[model samples]
Target chain A: MRNVKGPEIKSVEDLIGPLARVRPGRPGGEVSGTGARTLLASVTAEEPTGRTAGDVPVPAAVRRYGLRRLTLGAAAVVLAAGFVVGPSLLEDGSGGAASYANSAVAIEREGGDYVARIKDPFAEREEFGEAFAALGLKVGLNLSPASPGAVGEIFRVGTSGGGVGRGFVAGTEPSGCSPSEPGCVMVLRVPADFTGEAWIELGRQARPGEAYRNHGSAVGRYGELRGTDVDGRPVEEVLAEVRRRGLQVEFQRIIVGDGGSLSFEAVTAGEVGPAWTVWDAEAAMAGKVRLMVTPEKLDDNPMYEPGLGPGGLDDLGESDEPGKSGEPGRSGGG
Target chain B: MSDDRPARFEAVYREAYGRITAYAARRCDSPQDAADVVAETFAVAWRRVDELPKGQEAVLWLYGVARNVLANHRRGETLRRARSAGLDAEMADLYAAPADRGVEMSVIAEVFRNLSEDDRELLSLVAWEGLEREEIATMMGLSRNAVRIRLHRARRRFSRALAAAGVPFGMERRMVPAGRSL
Candidate 1:
């Protein structure tokens, strides 16, 4: 087997820095001392109640085994009834249960709206669809891999038939909960009586080798090149920094076509001269960077207008607008 | 054995608290969440102190617990078991500090974050936690070969994804020769 050690990329500690540098108290001393004492007290208090490690809920086994059907007896009945009565029963107010939960998802009817909390984001799409279908919803949930900032965000929605009035809204449970953070769940709220056939696509963690359908800029806050200014710099200077970081570099020659149309073409190292002007640099992948260059300096940076910075593009070829019905869109870094 | 549980827990807490706090801080978005994970992880450690491994291995055990706690927290299953105002304050201050953000850094972070959860965790165990392959295999309950294979696959996937995003070249597979054009 090949050695697992690869390039010397920045570690998470190097990227985020130490806790003491960011805070006042020592992490293990005063701060954790108080926390440890408090937690010990809480645990001691709970010990009288006979709560043990077994009492603490372990992560659901659903992740290990794929999606399991709704097993709650009452919830199962409600879902079974839904399959029999169909969607019309929900509007009649005769549906016995107003909520149902499985290992995969939990959906509740909140007045005129149906609130669904996605429990297993990696679960099969059919499982999500089944949960919605149980509530008599004609909604289809398609989860696609997205960049870090775009995960758990709804990127596209497409409706075909009737009854979509204003369509549905998709968001996180606690308003702006970061998907990577705790206590955050992806939420989809649809009007209870929506009769239209709708397809909703939400961003989920990408599988290995899967391409991210939704893209965020590699620059700016939380981006790879946060403070580096490569725009309008000499290729020689930028290449030196790239080499210094022990990172591989790739070059994209920016060609300005007629009518201000822009296109990028890959050029070999021999083709790109040291004096070529680099208009922009983007993180192409781990251990590698891509520099957008031109043989001569242009009047303005074609990648962005003045003062907009990284994600601010001045119409570089294709449209960058997001949430265009069926198309995957690019989102700015959060 | 039961009488010495408190002393053992204290020793482990004092030894591993800083690193555990850093671990949670790097992965969590908020200080409160990180605090909760740290507190809960130790609480579990206290409860199951018998299962806590000896000496340095204890920290690895706590990391495994913290990982599970974080997973539960992400699913919204972990109820707030231990909440300390002081710890929360400390975490808030830590988060308030400025990160080394840049366009390239953001892209790298995005690519890193975009990786599969398993891949991210495997890489983080090495990079963030600074664990060796044998240690990772022990913590993850896998054989050394399993760790080696998984880590290799994760690195390759990360490189491929970065290239697909237009960030060319895999560090392991595509090292550019010196004096060659970019």
Candidate 2:
């Protein structure tokens, strides 16, 4: 047997005897901590309640989750086959869960080829405008609505003829009512090949002693987004107050650079912590893209897709019986 | 007797569920992900309930099912790293100061992520699951002696990996820390 040595091992699935009794009315379902953790606030480590360790797989389990999972497996096979695509059409930030039915879309098929004119169940909705306004931070759009916690889709952004697609974005944090310290803020991320960059600009009130000079060109900036006091006001009022404070945002022009290099980055600037959480999968960011737009210039304009209205994310596969009560229930007490 | 079986199954589920959960938490990186392995493992047993051996033997065999399920879990761990649209903007910095009440969790998770899936699972089997080499052998289909040797190696490896990952190393695997209650 090719053995596992002291240094070659990583983790193990241990089995301790059961704890406590659930007899009669006893609340035998207590789930004390088991030491598993997730860095992203939304990525929870649930318990495997109502299930055991000595189990096997059968047809029913597969049939229930087959369609959704099959899609993912199919995607994996495509990427593994080295089929890469451009980021130009990656993010569809039209608006919440809106659908353009029976429309022909694009796909990266096996052997790294583009399968054009393929019909998608739905085209991603672009709601970055509403999301930007709702969060009250100045950022750029390069997003679309898709379920990551459920069945994740793919998104690739970069000038490299071949782009990397991480699939989806899910998980959100509680929204903030004000732009105070430690609150969530809205931010936009863009690839160097951004055309919207030149059109982008920033606007925020700069404090007297709170210098913005030390910060190099806005691309590599790291500031606390110091806010002005909007005493005891509603969230919308605070949004308006912040906008009137002039422009403090850094501007950038998205330009596809040399060597056919592919770079990725995330823009975290919002009052809501999860607002900054692009997806629960990756952390930090890498690149040299400049920030653009002030809070005022930041469009509080249309949030719906270029055509659709609100209620986009509503009723999407919600009735799909997510993690059913009986199909091998997992402990939600993560 | 027909009525007796469902009651018995419920009893078994109640007694063994948390144990399996604890076992999975130690080995798998995230509870939800670990729970997937655990749930799948137990669902197999439940479907093939009649095939399970009697008494303590059954417990040991359950460990075998968990082993296989975890193997499946490890294979898919790579998917968790794929790039996403909002990952940079949304995901909290893994190295930043953990602001909330999950420091122990973050530290443990960080340590867990750094370890290879194999070491983490075998050690968690012993420490978190409290399985003996003999029982583990039955579940994994290995010889008893081989189980002992493998378990020992797994434990040793876990210690070194934990140390390198900055987890409290001097402490034993069985020593449950103050934060991870139950």
Candidate 3:
């Protein structure tokens, strides 16, 4: 293939010559009649509920937190039993009203910012919004299901309107505090005078059939494949382990292209034979794992084949240790 | 500390509008589909403004988002949400414009279209968008070596297909190293 050089081929650009001629002119400027402005407005006006109608009722809290709306009787009963307490107001050092706390969240003034610590990640979304509303801010908080490594991490921060100074910052209280430890809490810091409408989405433990909005390696300590290295293992062995864990499995056939380049194609279970080797595993959803397999064993695990530091599982290092925090505002989801 | 998201997004939209529109126009089958992809891409950028990277990287990030949006559009998952008359008109004009379609170019276009979606995208990102390997890695969420390997394979497949079609390798020699086969 190397020595057979013909005169008809120049470059990929030449091959795409006239077909690349489609050039739509720029959309009108920021405020112009082009759909750009309208689209901007529509997206900016969107709330954090993942609904376009802007009127969907806030979803109920997940069952794991074991929390419910505190009715007058329920609140008094819980208080008497010493199982829970009502919201509390905390004053700053200067004796000013600077902080507020509820059963689900606590908002306090720290330096020039107000920090809201989530006490119950599974609390109803409305409870979070109400806390911010009480403090005269328009911030909305939604905690979505995520893999173990992403728990308590903020997935996205979106804001609109004006008067939002420095916007907001979301992180754990003790910096790298993991949700698995006591005294660890996910916190969001907002400017004291922030008056704009903002939407914040954080990660929480996923429920059955709830897809993870973000993920880490399945082989990490907290991952589903933890303590079980599936890499280079035969398909039957991995499938047995997956069934033992009561988890579903999917397969992606690894195709070695010319020059040893690799690509993957999703294949049905029947298409795979027990002799196929597993190259890597990914957290496909709450209770599912996707295995990358090949018909025969290769020279090296393609996941780490390119010598690019653990393939695409950069999260493995950060997510392996307990109580280790990930980078703030890590990019994931759409 | 000031809220400058709106301003920042506006600047990026202005700078990237044409390039992104052309990207959508190239992949989409119709003017409306192309317009919808453009609109949805920007809308997503606006919502995730804080995550949008700076300067040149921002365009690459937008391209990444546009790529996903295009995929969703192809799967019929994305609704025709952000349509406007102005965008529709612009896309229609772009698709309607005539091109210098020589017979050779036509044959090449057919062959290119016959390639898998992944191959077509990898090739176009190199030829049309003129993106480097690193930029493509960032845009596609792959390692640099992965992009290199995939690009090598895509090029080989394209050249072989061209050869099979009787299109001889022509005037300008590609910068393949002397002893390298592909």
Regarding TM-score, does 1 or 3 come out ahead? Answer: 3
C-alpha local distance difference test of each model: 0.57, 0.31, 0.61
Categorize the docking of model 2. Answer: incorrect
Greater DockQ among 2 and 3 belongs to: 3
Model 3: pairs clashing at backbone N, Cα or C within 3 Å: A6-B169, A7-B169, A7-B170, A8-B168, A9-B168, A9-B169, A9-B170
Give the CA lDDT, 0 to 100, for residue A3 in model 3. 18
Of candidate 1 chain A, the 10-residue stretch with the lowest lDDT total is A61-70
Best by lDDT: 3
Stretches of candidate 2 exceeding 4 Å from the true structure: A1-334, B1-5, B26-39, B73-77, B83-112, B159-182
Candidate 1, after superposition: displacement of residue B53 in Å?
A: 45
lDDT of 2 at A197: 14
- State the lDDT at A74 in candidate 3: 13
Candidate 1 residues A204-253, lDDT tens each? 76665454554332332333444344656788877776765676777778
What's the lDDT for residue A266 in model 1?
A: 77
Quick one: ranking by TM-score, best first?
Answer: 3, 1, 2
- Cα misplacement distance, residue B79 of candidate 2 (Å): 3.6
Please provide TM-scores, in order, for all candidate models, with all chains considered together: 0.38, 0.31, 0.40
Residue A175 C-alpha lDDT in model 3: 57
